[model samples]
Target: MKLPTDHSFFSSIRRLLHTYNLPTAYQLLESPPSKEVWKTKLNSAVDQHTVATWQEDIQEKPSLKYINTDALSVGKTHHLYTYVRPNRIDMLTAETKAKLLTGTYTLLANRAVFNQYAVNEPS
Candidate 1:
């Protein structure tokens, strides 16, 4: 099945980055998560009560900054666009990571839509 918003390729890349490994900052902060804990978190994050979980997860860390959305002006045209605001060194606590992982999985379940957006790379 394909994924929504993106594809397995990006998801795998994220998994590699977030997974408990020698390269992650999490390992430096705490002991590596056990397989059970990882699976449990993944499952819990995607459960029916996801929004609440996401809120809690997001609140876990001291927010560096809130995501901002600004209207982009095309100078030459009247067209404007809303873009995802970025943050520097955004740290995802264990909760956010689980939410992300689960959210991606949920979106990916929609294979047709997932295929449609998977190749839309950001410029």
Candidate 2:
């Protein structure tokens, strides 16, 4: 939801993996699942490296460990970030096309900030 405009390679990869695993914000509100459910879903959707990265970036961070209930409503106005290659545009399903037309999804093309300071900064 509220698709991040950061289109850098690593940021895109992270978003893709997170979306593949986690439920949408709306889904979380409809059925507030436990952390274990989230973890299981994450593990099922990604490789070991991704999972380990999640552990280090999110799970290990005190601020990010708990769900932020306030942010769940963001999905109502914005769809998840989706990247489609130019050549693969024709491969999208009818439903996906409809969503895109309806402005439920965003196609971000902006460059992400990726300086060394940002990468090396401690959380």
Candidate 3:
């Protein structure tokens, strides 16, 4: 999904950087980069944080010999494909989904609408 260049969006990223104790990254928020650049940086930070936490949690738990690491990798890939990217069938709201199904919503129009909807969507 394209990152929204709205103030609230940047503010949330600033808070996330602070929460992660990533002072260097937090500093970048003071003079934010271009939207594309910022999005890349943010994605990198999030991915690193996710992997770090997951590794830590796994280390704390008992090892499961039957667990297939390859399967776990595939599951993570599936999750990213299903939820992280935009324009997915399941990510659309009911109203939008209906419009799409009825051929009222074109991809071109939906891109703009979906980006706005995604930005304003509640956590």
Instruction: List, residue by residue over 32-106, the lDDT tens digit for candidate 1.
Output: 677898676555544424444445655675561252213222223321112212443233343355556445434
lDDT of 2: 0.56
lDDT of 3 by residue, 14-72 (tens): 67776565555546758768889877766766766776666666667765343344454
Q: Alpha-carbon error at 77 in model 1, in Å?
A: 52
Query: How close is each model in CA RMSD to the real structure?
Result: 22.1, 20.1, 17.6
User: Runs in model 1 with CA error above 4 Å?
Assistant: 1-30, 48-123
Off by over 4 Å in 3: 1-15, 21-26, 63-76, 79-123
Model 1 C-alpha lDDT versus the unseen true structure? 0.46
User: Which candidate tops TM-score?
Assistant: 3
Clashing pairs in 2: none
lDDT of 2 by residue, 60-106 (tens): 67766664433433214333324434455543654577667656654
Better of 2 and 3 by lDDT: 3
TM-score-better candidate, 2 vs 3: 3
**TM-scores, in order shown?**
0.20, 0.24, 0.39
Task: Give the lowest summed-lDDT range of ten residues in model 1.
Answer: 72-81
